[model samples]
Target chain A: MPEMVNLKINDISVSVEAGSTILDAAKKANIKIPTLCHHEDLCIAGNCRVCVVEQKGVNALKASCATPAEENMEIFTNTNKVREARKTIIGLLLSEHNNDCLHCYKNGNCELQSMAKDYLVDSDKYISILKNYEIDRSSPSIIKDDSKCIRCQRCVRTCAELQDVNALAVSGKGSEMKISTFMEKPMDYVVCTNCGQCVTHCPTGALVEKNYIDEVWDVLNDPSKHVVVQTAPAVRVGLGEAVGLDAGKSYTGKMVTALKMLGFDAVFDTNFSADLTILEEGTELLTRLKDKIENKKDVALPQFTSCSPGWIKYIEHEFPDILDYLSTCKSPQQMLGPLAKTYYAKSMGIDPKDMVVVSIMPCTAKKFEANRPEMYSSGYKDVDYVITTREFGRMIQQAGIDFETLKDSECDSILGKHTGAGVIFGATGGVMEAALRTAYEIITGREVPFSNLEVTPVRGLEGVKEATIKIEGCKAEWKFLENVELKVAVAHGLSNARPLAAQVQNGESPYHFIEIMACPGGCIAGGGQPMPVNNNIRKKRTEAIYNEDESLQLRKSHENPEVKRIYEDFLEKPLGHKSHELLHTTYTKRKKY
Target chain B: MTEINIVKDAVKKHGRKRESLMPVLQEIVKQENYLSEERLMEIAKEFDLSSAEVYGVATFYSFLPVKPMGENVIKVCQTIVCDMKGKEAVLDAIKDKLNIVPGQTSADGKFSLMAVNCIGQCSNAPAMLVNDKPYINLTYENVVKIIDEYQS
Candidate 1:
């Protein structure tokens, strides 16, 4: 353990770990120091200047978040000078901010709103200097409202440090300081992964997940509607946190009950569709491998997994030339949407137009994805509405449901049945594991050798991982001289994804298969999950997802009965004509603006 | 390579949306020096929109420039980068030599003066971009000399 340091905060004696910042010491001592840019998960960026506190001997107040605590140092946390400084800071920030919190997506929950109230800032002290900047709504997943920005730099730090996607950065300075990316390009065109981590860390409404809650409400309120809700696996582990449940505590049953209380006719699980995705994707991989064995035709080499919308959009914009490498399977959310409006609707004897499919996802990008024109497959809109796990929790609260004592329940049938493989889709390396399970079994016509089913190569939180597996009794060996080696790589986050993608683009990549998830730790740490999920909570959430996977009866995608039924009835076979028409889509060349 | 394609495809798909005209204009300007009439028409058609609508939207945003530009578009950081590092002197030197304000094109159309907020290259203050290539640690004399290389 590190040496300890003693500090006096507000005249109260405090001891903290050596190298701890004044802010950390204050937090330990229960001395509240309001901050905006200083997220624990990210590096200290003293841009907000809101956490300024007085040091007894220092001439000027210093930002506690960036200043280290000196031994025996005296700090005045709530002195008149500190209070006035904080009040002035809040007043200036609010003067330039939009001040539309009543109608903003982050109304009661916004940190800026609470801070203003905390400091009792009622007047616009710096209104004259507030620049009337234009709003940039160019991106689908994010909205850039400069008027609401306090120049906190939380978004920039989260994008750069946490996700390793340095898309946002502090631009300008002082009164004109704001966030922008590469010449103020719209986020959709930049290297932004649309992971929404910035939204979670944003202290103000300047950055927010583009809200589709009203659209969902409208869809649900229609009298002729047969609303169906599907939730991603990640949502089950964290949705309860939004309703005051502890983070990483699996609320699968409570979540189902909450959705039912929200008036949805059925509560389905995206895991079922995830299982279906693995089945189709795994089958596609095997067929491609078999095709390579016979040397019949040129199959798409190095088929990349396409279950992440963030990764999908990323590949479409940043790596369109390698579209062939991407698997045709839509993300589980999209897959479930189309299936609910088509297969589930038919089974329920409901009209596709009357059926409204909503997905409670742990991804903000899904809001943009649901509105995509290419997602329509059933000759009608596939998913009618999309809501984040956070938004769903709000709706649960707005309905006055007591989540703590809610009865546990199971998901509806048909679109609800899923395998353990599908449940693990929330965590990093899960897609790779699920695919391997199905691929090994499909090729050998039997279960894999290891019951543990751990593919160590794709099992960690590393930016990029690689492994090569040899098929027993396979003869297709061009790269390995008569021995077939199944090479694979897994990458999480766009920053790390960039170099790996460049390797593939430059034709220097040696791997035959690749899995990419835009968010670090996959959907378990999605952009739309509960905020303030530190390392501890994330690890717990990931553990919960994997635990759910381990406890399931069917741990392979091929074992899902619904997937088997889909292949038997409508799809016929993986990558067949109907599958191509309904499940696959193409990409377009985009401008860099 | 895959990253580049992802960027390209996202731009292509979202660029075609009517609401994404600003981003489309930004993308076009980033790739090609300016938004050409043909490109504007292409975008308008893709969005099932009128070229006037597209042009109006593009012109409305200060970020989007409309004319064909020089081989290199030099964006001098005027917001804070140049301000902290004496951007006024550099701007004055460029204006004296080129005879144009921040929004004007040079008489020979060899350069266009535009003020950018910040380039995130604050470590090397007084940054100016030649096309998309950022040159930092700039002085008034160095900026003039750098612009001279593109004069003709």
Candidate 2:
């Protein structure tokens, strides 16, 4: 369908589509060109000259990343000159980079290290010109260590382009060049969402999830402490990729077993509270809808989901005026944190103080979320420590547990039970579909007519999607002439979310409810989900999430007996006194700067 | 009147895009000597940029200082030509006379000293700038004399 450009790469003629880079053409010709600055999701930085090649007439070595293929162009990918230039550039990068590869967090998994291995960099001919920079661990989530940075600008592009946060940028020039925040302020003082996408995309250990592994080990070793761990819905689908399983493989059972082996006294699922969130959030949405439709009261329509801490922070800082539209529920991670400390601890007869709650989240922001001043509703830090899936994977390896050999196991009781609806929260549009499944049944007194209760229209890797569900049949007492088309919209990634939030802010939004996940492709493709995330990986994970949902016997959140029991035992009712005290939270505005 | 209005005017003159940020800051630097954190915030707002983005750009250029500059900035040339012309002696003379190192400003806030590589004055051999006005082809005695003249 597109015009093809014929090019001779390494003396092999190849026809690539017009505008394909020399790298792409080279790949078509079975030539592998190494690159450090080129990322699948970011623009061609061309800063790393590792991919330099010889063009027929060009005097200088051409950067294949930024150079587009042309008709009849002769490109040499593995020329001696090209190789030497690449080695020189890599040597320069090595000179600047701290060579503490033996103990670096990204040692085995790093892209640059793999390239250095491929090129067989034998010597550091240049003197080390590494400038010492103090590691910034002020932010609860990410650690910024510029000493290992290669100045690739991948994180800069990720923050500025994908998230639109612009919390980091290329600050200095030449030898003193480094990535920094506003006035080089500490991360806490700046407007960083603490999403950890930067960490996900970083080629080296320059940026990483703050290590709570030591602290976790300390708490685990304590004889008096009861360590309870909850795995986020996104973690099951993502953790597989880290443990040598195919991306998007369902390893939930193995993950739970690993947590047990790691000495987490009780292994819980955030999905339990994810289902709990639906009960509270769905009830709140219906109440607001009742206020608007039945009482004609002033209420914020198109109520936003509060399940993502990054989205919560974005709205807090950028769109503070529409904070009223955000559901007052804490994120499922935050909800489970408090409940594990209070509800689960109380029922188990353990002192809430003695119980240490840790959440294995598909988010770095969860680390920040756990430390919020308001999360102390349980009389202590609700979640004692939060580790990312990446960190958990490391712990599993550290304990020498063969994840592949571990038998499938279920989560511990009390805060363990989860429904299919709860499991679907990993992907974008999942919560909306889950809520619709329950909300429609609650209003109609019948199951959703759709087969498998899979709302196909709401599911996918699309950035933004909207659907209208016509409430046709209804129960007697609630019948106000049913046939109402409930308008709803789903968006993943904050760039897509900003417009949707604006529409609601301007009173221009027509939908009654909206679902927004901050990271692209929801928690499954979250900033902290997996390394080297791409569209293909997200699609794979999305399929797995849906597969997980479809495989479960209980598909709807309302049907989760654990949720019903929690309400009957402690919560009493959704959006009631205890729910408001524990599950719901208020957000304060933050300065945009 | 507000210094921000002048900064806003500079923003207007520099074409009001993110690309114009450095130039706008440069103009503001010409007016206000250096960028303050508050002015950087204002420039960020005016350019519709993030504080980190604007601040990063501000810090990238060596000529633009993020902190306040002294009334008089003294440049001591440390280029090859000036080094051959006994630049270290002249530097020591100025240091002893002004009682300040290369990075520090004088106690009275009158002078800031920097040992710059070159100011495009290779022809002038041992040229230096005491507030952009070159004192070229200088001797160590002349360096001391120049500092005394400025101090008085």
Q: How well does candidate 2 score on lDDT at residue A555?
A: 88
lDDT of 2 by residue, A1-593 (tens): 99999999988999999999999898888898888888878788898878999998988999998899999999988878988887788888888888899999889989888877777775748888888789898999999999999999999999987788889988867667789888878998788898888998899999998869889999999989999999999899999887767896878898998999999899999999999999999999888888888788999888999999998998898888999999999988888878887888888899998999989988999999999998998888888999988888888889999999999999988899999999999889999999999888888988876787988878897888999988878887556528878999999888788889888878899898899888888999887776889888999988888898889999899999989998899999999999898889999899787
Give the docking tier of candidate 2.
Answer: medium
Model 1: chain B TM-score relative to the native chain B: 0.71
Over A369-437, each residue of candidate 1 has an lDDT whose tens digit, in order, gives 877889888878888777888888888888899998999998888889889899888888889888888
Candidate No. with top DockQ: 2
Off by over 4 Å in 2: A447-451, A476-483, B1-15, B75-96, B99-102, B114-149
TM-score of 2: 0.94
How many angstroms is residue A244 displaced in model 2 relative to the true structure, after the best TM-score fit? 2.3
What TM-scores do the predictions have? 0.76, 0.94
Q: Which 10-residue window of candidate 2 chain A scores lowest in summed lDDT?
A: A472-481
State what share of the real interface contacts each candidate retains. Answer: 0.00, 0.84
* DockQ of candidate 1 against the true complex: 0.05
Full-model lDDT for every candidate: 0.78, 0.87
